[model samples]
Target: MKPTLVTQTALFIFSLLLYCAACPAQTAQPAPNQTAQKVYVGAYVMNLYEINPDAHSFYADFYLWFRWKGDIDPTGIEIVNRIEDWGANDEPFSDSVTVLKDGYNYNGLRMEGRFFHPFEMERFPLDRHVLDIQIENADYPLDSLVYLPDTANLIRMKPTLRLPGWDIEGCSLTAKTHMYATDFGNTDLGQEPYSNIVLEIPIARPVTYFLLKLMLPLIIVLLSSIGALVIFPSRSYVDARISLPIGGLLTAVFLQQSYSDALPDVGYMVLMDKVYLLAYAVIGAVVMEIILSANYLKRNKDTNLHALRRIEWYMALFLILGFLAGNLLLVFL
Candidate 1:
């Protein structure tokens, strides 16, 4: 009985050892969804390849640069940082706003994260530049979406928008209205393209000043000055007074038209407006001189004779003084 008991005890010990050996290794259980990953997000200036001028819209590719900061390999996951959500607050917008479940399709330079960067225009005049990033927020695990055989979850990465190394070829960003976003990743996963950050490219200062302060306003002023010189200033009876102002106004009109296709339709004045206003003023002066001359001729029988005589000096002095005073006030003030 003792021998049998010893043998049974030995057998039980052996069975326990075998069971332990067959048990799974206590190496390490991967944490639930592992720890969240961190990464840098930004945008880059691009050379526009195509453009659509009518909509004030164009197409340009945004190069995004980023670096991963996590314990696990940052693969098969995507990062979407800049999200334009019309559904927010139930605000309605166009029916064409494009949203990507795993890809992006739309116009304009869109991206997420801070570091305001602007592209050099003249390099790509027609393409809309977009730099927003889209990341796949998948967890790291065997049973997670990443481990699914034959499936790919590209790491969601915000586009890398770096500051210019040496004057980004042909672009510059205005510091005030330049677009940028803060935070590296979307903390919210429930929202599609989830990101609490809203990035906005403010109206470019140079572009705004150029179009409004220089171009469009000038066109308007030039148009208003039309038909002035032809009626105001004429040296000959054969349509000379009417012709120069007409020609000048026409020339200004043509110049204004040349750039009409490139500008957006907005209401504002520009440097061009100042120029046209000046041109109109000159045309008005021309008309006044013509009328004065005609009246002078009728009063004095020989207008040319009066012009060349003592009256000429007085008229010259008055005009010189008037112009000097006007220009001086404008310049000094």
Candidate 2:
């Protein structure tokens, strides 16, 4: 009986050894509870990336990184934009994708991730847009940690918003964000330059010139109005000097209000500001002219109707005609 028992034990042990050799012991997997992925976003400057007139063709390129902790590889993140026009098939212009690393596979782990040329900008010129990126865990698992950008080990990316002449309006950014899966913990919330585009504008001047916009037009109008005072002196001769600029001052006040709505409230000079300063000086000249004329013509000298009238007519005639001639040169030359 002992001999028989020993033989059976030996057979069982041999079978066990074979099983171990054939199928190694499996490492455990976490519970089926899925977690939403986390990702970091950044933008860099290069004089590259242009969109054609039709907006359908784009020559845009930028590197996006997907970073995470607890044994995560690049396969964890995906740049999820629809390839409708390109149609997912490999056509000549059908949206190309390339990676920095070729012939190197991460074997299910790569924190250094990049997605290039995933899709074109947009088909419409005037339409606003964005690209949505989704991230997930492909290998290993990471829980929360206590540090900057926490647990992501992202080191960082370069040159935050407003690329080259791309000053954002209001600096308010005009972007909206919605977060999901935070309940399970993705500490990397919405961040700067998370969304980026070259803005594709042929001219990137300031949308609203706070300093010089109204000032330019104001100078033009004020100059013209001063010439008008020189022209209309016979009609209202009592306050010839102060009349034009005072009226201009009121008009300028209204113009300034209009400018306030268009530009931010700030103290700085621009082309517009310089032009308006010229206008102010012109208006002040009109005021000074009136004061000097009043003193010379006399506070109590019987209103020299004929002599004053003659002076007004010729001065206005010469001044107005000269201004018009000069304006033509200014406009053309």
Candidate 3:
């Protein structure tokens, strides 16, 4: 009972199909990428109590948390931007982990510590700053663990959170790979990138503070200096006019020093410093005008007193307008 040619051909075709199906099962597939573990990180800021521009730091109370699956534990996190203070930080859940109903592991801790941020004071009272709480896993490199911001609810701040001199603008969260230049003491591993999560809080001073507290006093001092020009250009008024500008000069210096003490000593001048410089210049100019007028009165006996009075008026108007315009340009532009 030998098979026919057509039957033999059909048998060979079936055998080839079977072999093709079995080849895929026997051959090995490429391995999946299992180098990094994905971690979702978030923060709920309860309060921001102290912000010191001179110290370049701010005190914050917040809850930091992490969520992830599998066996990787990313709870051992460190605040990279935190200022070290012995026995100051309060972390109650520093050693606990919870397994959620969906099998994802969770861990959180309350942090009360000072965080460092180099504040940009070019604008001073008008300055806006982003205070950040940067976190990183000290034990895990970026290759082993990567942070993902919980975009659904990344940043949550308390409804009534407030800072004394600042207004809370908004908040945000971001994840990044922070690469270190040195590998600490590990010469074999070289430098490795670390997963970093930052919770940022944007804050700015209220415009009312700038207007009422800072600029209003400065304007008063400037006007007082200009008032010296309005006095009579006579011999009796010489002492009064000359002394008025001098007094204003002293007050302006005192005002500037008072604010400067609140800020760090930086090489460059801030906006408020520039404004004070203008004030000083205006006061000096007033003194010069008064001196010239007095010399004319002594030598010529109020010969061109009318012209001198007119010049003084013009000078006063010019200084006032110039100061206002300069301030506007410095602030808005």
Candidate 4:
């Protein structure tokens, strides 16, 4: 039978709707970034026992925890720490893995490992350094895996935690993408990328330790050298004056040697070195002053003895002030 025009129009519209629905409804393009895995990191530092600035390394005993949400088993995944000074002792003391029905993976361990700490020793004893414990995925590139700081689960020591000469200043956690080049022996690759999480602990050394151990004794010796100028004016007295400064000079040499044994082999001079140089100059000046003063006394200048005493006072004051000024410049500037 022949259909009317309106009925034919309705049938045409219905057919088109059915064909479109059958083909497929357009869905939002599956996000390209949905497959990326993010690993969360947390740590509790148990102890930091040894710190060797000369070696530029530190030892830390810590507990680490990792978590991620993924369908695949995380058991095969490896955790890498970039700050490892040596390859030995990288494994954790006790490691455990857990997988939940909801597709979450948890990994935790307690480990004591030696990590590398790059120290800034410009100020040496007065310097503050940030010690970093860095971790990342060894096998996965940044495209596949990333690390995040798990601030919720972070455990840290109090600021009171300190070594004999160091005080814990602060602590922080951060995560970022780290990129570097890999050498194939023949040529360098474009770039290799990894996700890094860093736990930073800042430590400071007290200035009083330096003052007492190094500066104080040197100051005492310098003061003792002044005694040379105050002694009786006799021909034999020149020997006493000479011996005083020479003894102080030797003591300074000994102290410097002992101190240097603990320091790194850096090329630049440090604050302590400057102080020692100043001390040596002062001692040497005193020796020279004593010689000149004794020669004047040998000329039977009893009247000029008072003038020599006044000169002695002037020399001591000048040396002391110069030492103080030099220290200020070295420390503050």
Give the per-residue lDDT of model 4 (tens digit) for 1-333.
356888999899999999988996674322213467877777777678688897788877766677788653232433344355454344543355676575667876666667777676768667888888777665666667766777776456634456767887766778766666553363554455666778788888887878898889888988887667667545676887789989999988998888888888888877788888888988989888887877767777454666667778877888888888988988889
Q: What TM value does model 2 have? A: 0.33
| Local error of candidate 1 at residue 326 (angstroms) | 10
Cα lDDT tens digits for candidate 1, 39-151: 33333433332223234332333343223433444333333332233311111122343434533322222322222233333321122343322333334322232211111
> TM-score: which candidate is best?
3
Runs in model 2 deviating more than 4 A are 1-203, 206-216, 232-236, 267-271, 299-333
Full-model lDDT for every candidate? 0.38, 0.39, 0.85, 0.73
lDDT of 2: 0.39
**Per-residue lDDT for 1-333 in model 3, tens only?**
356888999999999999988885652222223678888887889989778877899889988788898678887788898897673576756466788898888887888988899998899878999999888998988778888888778448988887888899988888876778787899999877788889899999999988998899989988989999988787888888888889999998899888888888888988888888888889999999899888878888638777888889999999999989988888889
- lDDT, candidate 4, at 247: 95
Whole-model lDDT for model 3 versus the true structure?
A: 0.85
RMSD of each: 25.3, 24.1, 16.3, 17.8
By lDDT: ranked, best first: 3, 4, 2, 1
